[model samples]
Target chain A: MKQYDVVVIGAGPAGLAAACEAYQNGAGKILVVERDKEPGGILNQCIHNGFGLHYFKEELTGPEYAGRFIEMLNNTNAELMLDTMVLAVTEDRKISMINPRDGYFTVQAGAVVLAMGCRERTRGAIGIPGTRPAGVFTAGAAQRYVNIEGYMVGKKVVILGSGDIGLIMARRMTLEGAKVAACVELMPYSNGLNRNIVQCLNDYGIPLYLSHTITEIRGKRRVEGVVVSRVDGGGKPVPGTERFFDCDTVLLSVGLIPENELSRSAGIALDPRTKGPVVYENMETSIPGIFASGNVVHVHDLVDFVTAESQRAGAAAADFCRRKEQPGGEPAVAIESGENVGCTVPQHIRPDRIDQYAEVFFRVGRVFSNSEIEVASGGRVLSVFKREHMAPGEMERIVIPKKFLENASGGAVTVSAKEAKEN
Target chain B: MTHLICIICPKGCHLNVDEQNGYAVTGNGCPRGAEYGKKELTNPTRVLTSTVKIKGGLHRRCPVKTDRAIPKGLMFDAMKLLNGVELSAPVRRGDVVLADLLGTGANLVVTKSM
Candidate 1:
């Protein structure tokens, strides 16, 4: 058994960023454990651009974005364990890890950062009734195979979701000389960025069918075709609207669930809303000294935000371990979604810290134009900003001034959107 | 009439524009239709990614990408410039493969090391 001042699990972008922060913040001994042979995590397989626009003020591909932090980590005092899978973590911050290279190890930590990230939702999880065929693949799996392994999944394909991965895969398959029959989306609007809809589909001349779903996946040993249908307003399939397309593969990108089995086994309270560990303003979970960030906290569209969030989590963990004073005493108020808004993270906000301003990230449920997003508490609007347009595919955030929280007497704080009244 | 194409989704709308009549668009489903139409009529843009030649490394080629979004009109030219380049090994990821390629203000970044 070895002891470390800070231990970060899963060396993805979040974990890498967190480990660097912890070490920089004066953690004596730091260890980063990654299950993969390499440390970049999912970013290694994400070969496309559109990351780092906010954090680095430039666009970068996934690997390039993640590599920036990895370079930083190399210069720090952090130690890394590759090919190591952390099996469990106790509420007391004890970790159990298995590495074929390092064998089994158990250690207690002054602080633990859970950056295991999230997992892609599979066919069984979504309950798409279909034959257990061989050609079915998740968008991420396909991305890894094509981008990293340099092998094509199939020649003709029909993707099942319009999530960012599925959309990007559609273009990827087409560019690699495969015929993408169509990109079927269950929702009325796409769950990807507008830029993706353009670059990944429209530019490639692939079709996107909205309010539609793959009712049945038809295949035996391999996918032969799929049954698609139009969905009703309530998101259920309408009878007689079925259509069939012969294809060789089915890609599922329905959604991502934060991987928290270890967190759950540790008896940490999970937030049902985010499907992640409930974290406070500092990204610390209900269990003290154990922090969580990145996709494990809640799925984020941009890797830039993930890096930024993890920095805070890492700094907070280092402070926890060092017994140093932190920016505390802000009672968090729950942030609820209203109208066209979806869910918000750090669900609770510290009213007392309002003077320090906080960056709130969220998603819109649908596409709308000329909208006013109002952050309110107790029915009184705290701040309002006008957005030219908002989409479900893009992650939206607002930096609320610290004064807004200082002015609030403490009631339910919610972020809601309303159509901007005609000027 | 400046014909504009809306590439917002798979539903590509070929928009007909009459510059004299303030550009009334004919084939747009969403407001983005109008936005794309206007942008196409003015400055079309796209993000470009490819590879660059590196020195002192393991593999023959290292994958390079754009550090920012570039104009669409400069895309094909950008790819042509990036395709012919090569880099040496030991080229760390995020290193600048080509700084300000063709003067679009977008730097080409290294994505994968060779």
Candidate 2:
């Protein structure tokens, strides 16, 4: 069996960044496996720009962003295995992979990095009461057809969710001469970025029905129309508020779930909230020497965040491969989200681990204004962050300095938000 | 007064620009917001990113974007301008398909080759 110092799965932004960083961090032999035919995973289909604003300091299209990383990877020593599907990963860092070119192969790795991104929520997952119609397609699927495949899915559309991809598609469809009837979002607020809402919907005069959902899709052969109605806070459809949109298609942008079948098969501990593996500060999973990052760990709002986090995972994996096994010290402190916060990544932090600081990313359950987010450890306050506005759609981040974590009471750290008092 | 939300960052600061007072801005979080507020009301611009019809390549459509942000009001027209573009394979990234986009100096350049 072939052995490598590091093996990164999925050649998307996450995988590309991880492998590049791993090679840069002194990993002698690294292999990156990608299921896609090309190195640029979903980014190839995502032709629209508005990416790399933070990482590259310049707004770039999806393919452009991935291209830069692929260029960076060309300079590194990491070997890429494209069109290869990772079947399973064992607890011992052995990956079983197969491809059309290569029948099957197994390789043992000193460290494994899981960078497989997330998948979109399908119509079946959301249980939209619709007939088996031809015009039904996931937002991403339709995006692939229009952008990459150069095929039009429908002439008229009614999008079910206000997801960023969905919003971008609305504009794309309009530009292609498709009339978007309405965008029905179950949540009152949009799941997309503020810029998307302005550029896609508000600018195009597309009516956004907030707190509304599609109750029934009226179609026998193809999607002819859909029945939409307003929903209360409890998510129950209101009868009188029923409305209909005569359209040919319905694009679902509901939600995304972490693609973690391989991670689950690896016997790694999974976080119920993030649907990804629970890991230490170094992104090392429950299984030693195995690490995870990007959307596979948690659904990140920004690809820039995915790149940054993957770099850490890559460096950590390289560091793990270089260092000899030793007796571990100090139980890691579990980080918990307190009031108003949803879930915090890096569920646990090992203070003894070498690091400058851990940047924790999370989102709030509800919107708040003039709020102060406080971090506490063992009932003692650690840090306080003030925010002008907080929304569930936007992911929030905070830094836990090494000094604060090292001197902690060895108890779990909790982060909570509260309304700021007027002086 | 023209109300707009600053999209420069995640902050999404809401700004109210008084057109009567030379677009005096309010409710901005930073200086960027102030600039965005003034430009948005006076002359709004956005970078146009989409695909042009491609032939004899791996993909049928090659992604392209304006070299720089052009007038927001000109986006629909710019897209119409792109609709007429049909290129064969061998197109390189940053290859300008159309120069002087709507006379805005923002050239429409291909972001990906095939």
Candidate 3:
């Protein structure tokens, strides 16, 4: 049995950042465990730009974003175990990791940070009524194929969802000398950032079919074509609106689910909304010593945000190892989504602290323009923010002021959205 | 008449400008729209990203990013400078592609290693 002061699982952006934080914050030793041959995780193949807009102020590709933190990790006393998979994490921070080179090893740590990112929602998850053909690939898989393996996924394609991956792939496929017939979006609005739509589709002249869905995939050995139809207000396929496109491949970018089987097995409570661990203000889970960040906590669209969140988790884990408890006083309020709001991250908040601001990340349930968002507890509006428009696709984030968090007496926070009155 | 714009949301409004008055907004969809529009029209800016050329590599493009936000008006000039850049291979990620982008006081950094 080996031991370290902190064991950071999955050496992705979050994992790497957390490890660096723990090391910088006086953790005696830190071990980063990654399943891949490389430690970059999804960022390794995310060759597109749009990352680091917040933290770095410049647009970076995924690998670039991950690399910045990995560089920081190299300067620290953090040890990395690549090609090693963590088999399980016990309640007391015992981690079982395995790789062909190292076999199996159990390490006990004073603290653990779960940075195991997320997995792409596949065709099976969506239950898209289709024949399992050779050309059906998750957007991420297709990304790996094209970006890493240096292979063209298809000559003509129809993407299933407008998630960032699919949108980027549409542009990538086009750049690779392939024809992207169209990108069909199931919802009334795109599930991607406006900039993506503008750069990936609008600039390239790829038609985006909103409120439409792929009804069936017509393929045998490989993809031949697809049957698409428009959806009604209730999202039911309109019978008379079936359209077919001759295509070679279908890409699914439905959504992302946090990779949290280990968190679940260790009896950590999961947030039903996020399908990830229910974390407190410090990114600490219900289990005291276990902390989570990045996609494992909630799917973050930007790598910059992921890095920031991981740093918080790492710093908190280090504080935990030093026996420094976050002074607990006031009960936190549950943040609820109201109206066009989807859900918020850091589901709970601490009301007593002077620095009580909680970074609330959310998505609009639908698209709206000229919107007023209000944060309130017990019928008193705590804070109100205005936006020109909000979309279901792009993730929106705001800071809940320390004053509001400290003043709320009850253990609940509600965020509501209303259409701005036209003047 | 403060031209309130809502770039925060997708609604990019062109409000009638009257900074002389006490922040009165027109042509906005919501209250937030008015506030954002006022801020943006008064002090308009945005985040910028563009790629620098890489030399002696199979990968033609190694993405570069700003270390922080810059004025939106400087974007075209930034792109002009970035478009003329060419760096050699063996460039690791986070390497400084352009140390300081034309005195914007912001560094243009490589995000991926080619």
- Worst 10-residue lDDT window, candidate 2 chain A: A325-334
Indicate whether candidate 1 or candidate 3 has the larger TM-score.
1
Candidate 1 vs 2: which has more TM-score: 2
Model 3 misses residue A335 by how many Å? 2.9
- Compute the lDDT of residue B22 as modeled in candidate 3: 57
Best prediction by TM-score:
2
TM-score of each: 0.83, 0.97, 0.81
**Model 1: DockQ against the native?**
0.19
Off by over 4 Å in 1: A324-330, A338-340, A351-355, A421-423, B1-110
Candidate 3, residues A1-423: lDDT per residue as tens digits? 787888999899899888988888899889998888777889877766666766887556677777777788889978898888888999888998788987888999889999999999988887888787789999999987776555778899999999888998887787566899999998888777765776578656899999999999988899999999999999999999999999999998899999999999988999888889988777888887899999998887777778888898898888888885545545766778877787687777665532646788887777777898889888888888988777666678888887777667576778888887677
Docking level of model 1: incorrect
| Chain A: TM-score in each model | 0.94, 0.98, 0.95
A best-first ranking of the candidates according to their DockQ comes to 2, 1, 3
Give candidate 1's TM-score: 0.83
DockQ of each: 0.19, 0.65, 0.13
Q: lDDT of each structure?
A: 0.81, 0.89, 0.79
**How much DockQ does model 3 earn?**
0.13
